[model samples]
Target: MKILHTADWHLGQLFHEYDRTFEHQAFLNWLIETINSEEIEVLLVSGDVFDISNPSATSIKMLYTFLREATAQNSNLQIVITAGNHDSASRLEAPKPLLESSNIHIIGTIEKNSDGSINYEKLTIPLRNKLGEITIWCLAIPFLRMGDYPSVANASNPYSEGVTALYREAFEFAKTRMSDNQTIIAMGHMHTHHAEISDMDKTERLIMGGVECISATAFDSEMKYVALGHIHKAQRIGGKEHIRYSGSPLPMSFSERNYKHQVVIFELENEITSLKTLEIPVTIPLLRIPLKAEPLENVLVELQQLHDKNDFEQAPYLEIQVLLEEPEPALRYKIEEVLKYKNVRLARIQPYYPNKKESTSEFNQQELLHELQPVDVFTKSYQAKYSAEVPEHLMELFQQTLIDVNQTEA
Candidate 1:
């Protein structure tokens, strides 16, 4: 049985603020072509089908078109999909019944029967030939899905223990459902093992509950191969045997500039016969140039040092960190001109004093406090003294009184 393990599709994703629709379209085309050429039996999309919880209508259409084309091309091809935290399980599972009729199995969340047994949850996709049957047990462990298990709500100690226990129960149930002679191939979207993380991913995780790191040993015993998603980088976990993460199809962030997007292909003869990684070509070139400048002249000199000087005129997306004693409007103007390298985007302006090491974690706490403009010293003193819950309207009145007192004091 030949299966193509790909995950973290992140459809409708944006690279920086740039629309990735065109690049996504190109990638979809490439994926379809590869499927056709490879004569793949199963296309396993581990998770993160959509980049956002609520995707645009156009994004939905793109997915529909891709599915239609794929199903039409290969009557035998089976597509299995699950939802990552980025996607709403309900939204992703909307067309589940309809899609299943077309040989596509969508497991947005774990489904358990009253008997506590995995039913249709373990997709026993058959690879039939004259020799016998080789079945792949498609196990979908959705991201942030707590409905399947009862033990994971606001638990004491590390939440991972609860998560691990839930999966163990689920995996134990899934194992019983799979055909004994057939090989089991499990799929999920989550973090596993220690690995290098991208800057953009790090930023996004901050807003989302970044508490996710599962040991690979959880699935090591039951399944022959485990295909994971979530993490953007393609990696081998659990001692690099059959467990692996097929990274996102494209670079979703500038921090992933160094990562080459790819998918994993496995040839199975009971156990995985052969496995190979395929790289997806970038539809558009992504160039990130960090220019540090204390003065306008220094900025220009650094810009000249870039390999493609014309890239400035191209308005390439950029992150500029400036360390200056005094950054003037004039300097900003000259920097903009030099940045006229085509499509040059000023991502960030990080100003620092000369001979001072910048503390990346520290922020201007005093400025934030002053911006609040506490009314009078008495009002501030009152706030500090009180710990009682105030009503919304009362809070508003208090804020206004404080502002007035602050103005009066000024």
Candidate 2:
């Protein structure tokens, strides 16, 4: 069986607040072409199909078109989609039945049991080949909703067993339903254990109590192959060979520039036989330049270094860091003009005035005020020149403070 693992599409995502509709359309086109060429048997989208929970009408329309096209074009494909934290479960699940007719499965929200026990809400979707001999069971674990675990979060022993109990609700259900005869392909939209991570990956550090820092053992079940997501860097977790994160298709942040976006193609016999990754080129270019030095000669030398490095171009987005002791107004203008010619977006140009003496603890009130708003040096002068007169009652408080000081001395 051939399986394609991809995730974090983040459709309708804006890059630095700039609309990425055209870029996203290009990505989808690439995806469709690749899918057709690859002849993939199963397409698994782990999560984060949309950029936001409440996607715009245009985004929704684009998604529907893509789904329709995927269903219509791929006759042998069994497409399975799961809801991420960014998706609305109801919205994504709305067309599940209709899509099922087209061999597409939508696993959004957990299913409930008649006995009031939580069941595999979106788990164990199976596809059978002719002769009923070959069966592939897709175990989909969508974003786990905390509310689905009544026995855990709201249990009598909430301190230690809360999270463990909640996870057991799903694991226990999956264990009971799993069949040894069928080939199980598990997919989840969560951070897993021992996943190789790079500093350049755009995923922010999960805080002490964040969701992404979940225990990897939660997924240790009787599944042959595991496809995971959430971390934006494609990697294998737990050294299990089959477990993987396809990562985002594009660089979502400047920090992610070094990370190459790719999709995983897994060839399965019993376990993941072999894995091949196809690198997807970035949609838009990013440029970063570090300029350090001071004075005309020193700054000029830094500029020379940038020019010699072939970075003096205007086609890509730019991040230039200017490090100087004290750049003059004229020098700043010069740098801005040169950067403008290259069509560079100045990320930041830090001014370092090393000669400026630090203020002492015994500094006067006026000096302190000046320190507060150093750039607006004339604020104190303006206030003193044209400020409103102080009220008598407020002025008397100042006088009382002086009197209290004098009494203390006496």
User: lDDT: which candidate is best?
Assistant: 1
C-alpha positional error of residue 156 in candidate 2 after TM-score superposition, expressed in Å:
13
lDDT of 1 by residue, 100-212 (tens): 55778777766667886544444444444334454655556677454454464566524455557656665665667666666666777777757446775676643326555
| Model 1: residue 173 alpha-carbon error in angstroms | 3.1
TM-score of each: 0.77, 0.71
lDDT of each: 0.69, 0.65
Task: Name the best candidate (by TM-score).
Answer: 1
Candidate 2 residue-wise lDDT, 1-410, digit = tens = 77888988888887666666766777777887788888787889898888888888888888788877876787777788888777787788888777756778888787778987666645777765534444666777676556554555454444224334545555555556556655667777765545555553324433223343455455555566777777788877766567678898876666666787899987665566778998886666666554342445555445544432234332355544444443245756776666554444544344544443444223335465635543233333323432423345644765677688789999
Model 2: weakest 10-residue lDDT segment is: 306-315
Q: Evaluate model 1: give its TM-score.
A: 0.77
Report the alpha-carbon TM-score of model 2 versus the true structure: 0.71
